[model samples]
Target: MDGRAFLASLRTTAVTRVEAGERVAQVSRNMGVSRSSVYEWLRQARSEPQKLQASPLQGRPSALSPDGLHDLATALLAGPESAGLTGRLWTRELVNELVSRDHGVSLTLTSIGRLLRSLGLWPRHSLVTWPDGSARLWKQRYAYIKEKAREQDALLMRGGLVDVGALLPRSSLPAAPFGFHLAYALIPGGPLLFRAYSGPANAATFLDFATGLVAETGRATCLITAPHPVFDLDECARGLAGLPLTVWVRSDGDARALRPAPAPATASAPDLRPAVLGGPSTGLWTMDRLAGHLSALFGHPVSTGEAEVLLSAQNLWPEGPLPPVLPPGSPAVGRWCHDVLPLFQAEAGPGAAVRFVQEVPLPGGRTLLLAVSPDQERRFAWYEEARYQGRMRATTLADFTRRLRQDLAEPLCLVVTDDSGWRSRDLDATATTVGDAFFCTWADGCGERVWRIPERDPVQALCRRHFHQGRGPAPAGTASLEMEHPPRGPVGTADRQVRIAAAREHARRQPLSAGGRLRELVLAGPPALLTTRTLTALLSRAYGRPVDADRAVAVLRDEGLWPEEFPSVEPGPWEHETLPLYLAHAGAGAAVRFVAEARLGGDLSLLVALDRAGETRFAWYPQARYRGRMRATTLVSFAGLLLDDANGPLCLVAADEAGWKSKELAAALARRPVLVVAAGVPYLCAWPAGCGNRAVMGDQCRTHARRSRRLAVHRARSGPLLDAVRAASAELAVARA
Candidate 1:
């Protein structure tokens, strides 16, 4: 029953009980009204005799006539939205507006209230529930994206459906609280809220969601419906300033009559930051993305402003943007020359130098001839059990030591091929003494073996000296093995690192330059390795002397290795600036192909060979950079050499800094504009037309410095016509009388 009918029945029961001699408390219980209320009604009945009667406010005329009242009740029952209101809730003002529109009766909110009381209808703010069909529509929208993305290479296209829902119960009145929002995004991970945000959702929630959608998906689209009044999508579209996000607001329940969302206010910054919102470039409580995440997590909508407040209060990023991560893949130590520059530690291949192959430097003028060969067992294998089957070599210790001692004389050792299945026959005897020869069982990776002969006992070395030797393919039917000798000379971890760099340096300077042609070779590489250390290391290894690394950088930059506009992107783990991992693992031929196909722009240019050095002087203006020059190097080294005309001419010459350091090369260096004649590394120097950009002359620098020091000399002057002289590191600034 309505409030009026219920009140009337209570009055009737209370009056009847009072007349029947029942007490006020008993009457109150019977009538379900307070005792004072029953007493007041009984007194009114005794005095006026008609006050307890319920006749619907008899004698007073209702502002909304019975017909108007009936129409208002009908309109409210049909919902405010049906009667042309913003939302589904009812209010006195909304009822007033409804009466005027549907019944042609202008009534005040106060009069509407009285009419509502008479018709068993009381005003209330309706509870907010998940919008009808919103979730299903949201899912369907995402499904559509997935399907369309398949045709579009799994990319999120612009102008797709976006749905956001957020629930915020009012602390004061949760039954019908004032907070509810929609989750907004077509992406799978929905908008999320900052942790510990229990307060009501607001504009910030939606803002946060929208911002994330624009950034992550690069989508500019939205869907609007009439059920929610606060979300004015056309007005909301202004947030995505730089993106192409388009907002579509549903109008009149018709598909074609939709209103387009408004454009953003101004242009936004470029999307140069990382993919995630909480990256270092982004704020701790980046409102837009936070809203999106929270909405998605809570299965409700979160606004950008709501998200911002929560985030601002607490820290979202305890650390900076996460390091690049990749899926786990492992087949440890396969090729020995792959990632981490493997061939450096233990050398056992053909053509390796005698020094590199030896187990250690024999004490005081002692020498040992060691055999070197390749492990063809792992020649075609990359990693793990797949390639490890045939790498083991079985041999008894006693038998091997007998052959070594027989072949070599006193103070000589034999490093053999015993990578696998080599162990001491008896553990009790650590060192086997046989006829003044000490034999210790030792093995290394890639099927390499070693036998040590210490002429003197109690070797004072803690660990073995790490060395690599051997080179070139073996003769018919033989493995290309180098020195696989083990010794007692200790090599620490730091020393190992330094030696690894040195090994790569040796290979790059020697083997990489060993190709047939020099002048026509073009070295196309990434700009990342055009630095001082790498170039100096190259020349030093090639020339076998210390070349100033800084001078090398200056020369190569003159040779056109300086990238004008360097592009940067966050690299994944096991990655480098100039080279892709796939290319890094591939052979030299594959690398050449990759660089040729790569449409590099900005500073990432191919090193071109400009001129071949003449017998009398360095090549007259080395002005060309190419890609064919890169050989026998890891692709991720960010360098390549080429000799193709497909790209524009790059004036860069690659040469050993030592070779180009003569005084005669200066004449050639003075000729070229935008000249890049690198002393050590290919495509790593720039000696432009003027001295405005520094040029590093390898050997010529010392000669020039001596000359400059002489030219810099000047006559001394008596200070203030008295007794001091000057001209050390200063100029005269002479004033003539």
Candidate 2:
């Protein structure tokens, strides 16, 4: 029977035993099952006896056997290249082809998809890979340090250097900013220690702080800091020598996992209720006055509405109803209903000569003059005039008014304007010469007559709409008339020529293919890596149509822009040796650790050793150096340099990998008590207190492989789920509005 049938048979036996007068607890113990499970089986047998029976398996059998499926999964993990596919990505079609060629099983695309999902494989867009087992390493190192601190009865602290300029409030910043500050806090509810320094953080400043820390502690203390350059300098090492301090510099990933202690409570502000209620009864308490008073007391900006809420919470309301807040606009908008609108309506009779004018200053020393007539057959004219040195000439306005009168054939023009610049004597005289009346719209608070323009003037609204449409992309089969030639008047001949030349050049260029354009963009900029999703978006924008990512990849591949293989290094033979060694060295008692420079793909080149107590300590090079090349002399020099910082004996180990099979490396290590061994070494599993099995994969044994696969699937699905949730929240907010 299969695994599922075996479990069903076991459950049926348990229920049968319980029905034969056997105690549920005793049966559970005998069968190594929980009492709850035995009771549940009994209940199931009473209600649905068929559930306890091991029925024959249903459905069609899979085309591939178990070993065949395993081979396909291994091939998929090796990627599409192993199947002789031409592209890096694996679609259902590729997987189907691979299955047919390898196992002689011709499955449909849907079946291939089911097969891939069953093996826990999914499509990814980007090429970046994260190290596995980093979280496991972090937990192990953290627990080791905490145990060491507890045994020594030393005060444990966790902190690092920070840029004080970034953390301080704007009001507290000095006239000239200084950058670095050292801050450490005792863990599990202890006082914080902070020291600020001027200028950037350097070896000298760090050494000074270390001296002060030694003097202040005067006893054994364990301080954990992030791996920083200042701590590794020779000056810092000399200054910290023979001190009663044990400093541990953790990797960036591990250091970020440390949780900060809760901060002490800040002193509360003095109560302002007595001061506000005792006096200030001479006049009504306005919200604006209260807001200003509260802002001063709290030392931050506060609005009138916030002040009203605060006062209401304290059982203090304003004397009367608050004034309604006005909408943001020009001052003339307030008097539009009562002042100037009636005059315009009175003049809008049959054959009336009424015109609305709007003057807007634009960037690049230019002004837009727009005029519109309010009638069923509305007529409008606009002119863009370039001013010299930002000064508007009266002649430009005169010319626009003359053109409007001639175009509309209105003899007596009465124009309404809001700009105070219309009060120019030259403009008024020109208007009088043309039999036109230019009325200025300004509402003075007096018992006299006033004229003001409405907030949404017809001419200004039309001008804004026209400008916005002009900025957008033109529709297909449509062309702008102004592109061929510049508008008449004011613009110099040289400027007109330049505009025409630019338009001609833009028209002469032929459209490029999506692949060609994408290649150009990739070659032009810093984002050297482009995912399939990013490629689809870029190509769709370039071609003004939706382009599928698979199609884009095909086109780029045909053009030799994309490679057939994914950008990843194959797992080298040394990773198995390096990973276990690294984990072994990361245990409780090692005083210093060093990692050799070797090419161990998928993980950093790490070195691990065990002392007499069988405790492990680990050290590794930077993750970026996983694929980097280093000479034997370079490795030996670095190892010698790290020996200066070692508090106890140091040992180096060589693997059977190609990089470690060097005569020079072996000779150099022979000078020290280093061991160079080949394969067949029995190493413990990298899992936390894992089963005593030899590792077959990178660092995990076969027992924990299924658990690791489940965790990997969970990590893959979590990111997309979080992104979907955030998108839904934003969409909900927009819908509510």
Candidate 3:
């Protein structure tokens, strides 16, 4: 009964009992109601307003009025907070509370709930909620989805189907909790078709199924699928020529239509409480709907339910996960389509009018009807026995019938060359040994050779079980035969090296000049840029040809194969200007200190050492200034600041600093002339007579001191100047000795 009528009946009973002066418990028992029920009814009667006894409030809205109730329900469903409420989700209790506090109208908790139920507003599990703001981002970030759909549609118009697979939320599938996917494709004649899979899905597997379809049917406008690094899209640009791409977006129900009513409120419905109300992306269902709308625009019935099934089937089937293993697109599934379509065509061969069926697993672990051929029942009866005896390897009923068709095409008949013994009999047919075995099974229920067969001839029972009683041409010869082997070349180091060298030479001749090709012969990637250490690793396995690091380095250098300049630098106080310092003193002195410092650091002065023989030149320079000021100085001082080494003259080359790297340093060094540094010391000449006569002075300073010493005695003045010169000369001689 309606809640109001039930309440009114209870009130009448409660009043009658009270007027009769009856006890509450006795009255409750007589009325077949609980004491609480009776008490509640009495309470309702006492709390009733004078509306029944007098005039009702004019134009006052009713708490349970159809219009007001619908408004409240609609607002709560949209989002509770949108109705000026505190929470995003509405609980029945919360809804009741809001209604009772209406200021002018009030309702009982029971009445509020009854009103909602009457208005078809019962509570339900929340639908899958995608990121709140994804819808906005989709148009910008997911334009690819539309582009792919359009391409797919265009292909379908020309008689093609684009196969695709995707993982969608359970709400989208509404079939299983997890592992379920959506497999879909576009057909020229109509909209998309779909199936489901409850397992792992990969690009290769998806492509394998596509290949089957293509090989079966020669009908495809274009292939389309969600873009994946491995599947729909190629990892390299070279693999993308003449290819199609797809886009998969996460969204809720179609953005264009109403979603299914929230799942019925029950223990079975899972709670889907989102952590945030409005976030980055909208729900997957919404995106799915948007995808559907796009698909629909292309004259395809873009359906959410169909999309879910399509993705699921691709994942469940074998070979669907192994994408690109066949071809870039689903050429395999396409092949399957090509093969099957012909068999069903009007011009198909005789006995080709059989039915086809597929056995597929349901989402809830149940096996159910998927597809069936008109002749499936008759077809199954003929092949079921052979399938049971292990003569056929068909797992499903439909598969069994397919195997039977193959058998029927080539029946295991006894070919009699001379019909002499009981020509009317269908038995004792003459044929080859293996063919005879199969013919005997057709006539005698099983091949007859157990007792007469020799033990060494393993084909005795194997031929009967594997090749007998099936449709196919018989083998040409007996089983006893030797296996043929492919030819092999002489195995030795010299031969392998010859092959490798030839391969390398061929690679070098290629127009691209890609180092990767040469490296692939020895290792992988570019080989020319490899250091001696890396090169040694590639040659380590060559027989009898041991590699000495020093010898290898020299050999490569002599051949101009190894980098002439090691791209390394020493730690030095001389900054980027280290190269110029070394250039300033380009004679013999550059050898002793340059060798020790460069080895201790990295090969920093490579450029300076290259031009160190005779020319006095400098190139490397540090050009940055502090504020508006420029501290111009000798190259040596500038080198000291740029490099880590303190005592050495600047080299025209800046080696990579031991602890620092700068493009500026490299760019500055690149402008210099090449120089070589030797690892030896020069013979010392006699000490000069001035500047305290330090014998082993650097080249630039040594010459300056010798000139100054020669002129010092002659340039002296007569009195104190001459006396002072004599004293300085005496000190210089003493310091030198």
Candidate 4:
């Protein structure tokens, strides 16, 4: 070979020898080159292993043979629908299943996707966001509508009115979506005038359409409509300046006089033109949009997860005799007619939309097949009739299982309740036997067991076992079956009994009017707002027995726990302590004195004072000898019959100099003769009452504050400690002198 060939041959020989574990010395000797040459050859081979393996040999043969690829690509190009797939889109799992069935070789979704990509097929999707009145600046536009509705009604009532609006959905027509704003005018008794332009629902298009409609309608015409871009702006207003046309934008739900007809040009034989109001149906989408806007005005606004209880609930009240309960524009509250009721009664029933699709009928009634479905927002269950005042949310397993299957085709099994930790015995059930499928019940809320049914796919079967596998109940378990699976009476019976017992005892020990007691319960509560559930729960715990929420509300209302009306007069600013400090100084157990109205031989009702955030109580001044005490019963009525006419209102004065507000407190005290001695000081008050609901003194959490005095000094003073000190000082001084 030539020199290049010889060098290449030598390098190959050296690299092969080195890689074969031959010593560098042996490789160099065999190749007739230096040891350095062998090392260099090996290093090149190691640096670029790909180059060493870069022979024209085939890599692992394609998973599919040439024929298989040809056939597979053909099948895919035909589209998923042609292959009998349920969904329009070709998902990876579907593709995998299809390929496995056709080729008799299972391929993962990932691999099939790669094969499809090589065959030049790709996936496409459609995405959309719904457009509505709730677009940007909705609040501003809504406000504008509310303000201008009256003017629009006047214009519409005049004669020739042009109403403009965009059609329901965007279309794929040349203009493509955000359909044209159409200005249609039905002149009373005259020819119908209409104009349509394809484009965005914007100010420019609106102005153009309005101009065209005005031209067709002639000089004297009025256009009234919901506020849109062109109509609401100054530019459109300027465009109509020269014309005899007036534009009025309607406000939300503005009540306006009916538009009277204008005389036709000749009234020649009925002008057989199409009437816009009596035209073909705008279809469900348009009606849905109408319902949405109307509902907002009627208080059944479009919000996610709200239930449809009645037509008033959805605000789809049509043109008919309005339901007796519905008041004009307002939807009826807490009541609805059945005709307009929603398929989902969750909002009406206070639970959520649930489906008990599969049913088995018996002479008794029907039984429901349940499968656990996870939902984040609502609690759904299948039951027949709601139990007494029973919350739709709260249901027994028996009831849920007994609901007659409403829809038949569903094959899903119901999974029990979720992670509230507070489980209802009825909602939480045991492993039940229903047909071939075990209605499995497991206590662990963390694991969700769905699709555990016998899987045809081995891979799917393995996954089923992996996810649903969990520990079963013990053969010798000591779990509380009685609590978990209670016999049918009512739910929460034990809880109610405990609560009733506790509450009755507390009420007997400390009596207050029913309403007052409930108010106190509400005021002293930890939660900021009281819901029936929370209140009922609270009442149950406080008293012994079941606390029905509706009953509690009724009791509170009856008690006239109404706020006291403050006298039109405002309290003048004077020395005063708020709740905390007031509770401290001149508080309970503090020395107090009541001053008399008359300077000489007057009646002084000295009493111990009690105050709360809402109300105050007074008792005989502690250690008042024989003075009578005041009771909580007459707290508001206990105004001083005599000394009440104060320089201002009788002030709550502190006896201690530290606690007292000013010299006014002392001067006022000196004016009266009764003296109170407490902790070596005296607090004085004329005991004015009926100022506010504060009597309305609270105790429970706030109603949490209860009165008690500070800790007392316990140490005894030495009899002669002061005298002994003085004598010692004198003796020491004399000795020093």
Supply candidate 3's per-residue lDDT for 527.
Answer: 14
Worst 10 residues of 3 by lDDT: 167-176
The runs of at least 3 residues in candidate 3 whose Cα sits more than 4 Å from the true structure, single-residue gaps closed, are 1-290, 295-529, 532-580, 583-672, 679-737
What TM-score would you give candidate 1 relative to the actual structure? Answer: 0.17
In model 4, the worst 10-residue window by lDDT is 331-340
Using Cα atoms with residue i matched to residue i, what is each candidate's TM-score against the true structure? 0.17, 0.17, 0.17, 0.15
Error of 1 at 377 (Å): 57
Per-residue CA lDDT of model 2 for 418-472, tens digit only, reads 3333456777422211111112111100111113223443111112223343343
Error of 2 at 248 (Å): 92
lDDT of 1: 0.32
**Model 1 stretches astray by more than 4 angstroms:** 1-5, 29-40, 54-98, 107-245, 248-737
The models' CA-based lDDT, in order, is: 0.32, 0.44, 0.32, 0.33
Kindly provide the TM-score of model 3 when superposed on the true structure, using C-alpha atoms. 0.17
| Native RMSD of candidate 2 (Å) | 42.4
Worst 10 residues of 1 by lDDT: 375-384
What lDDT score goes with residue 595 in model 3?
22
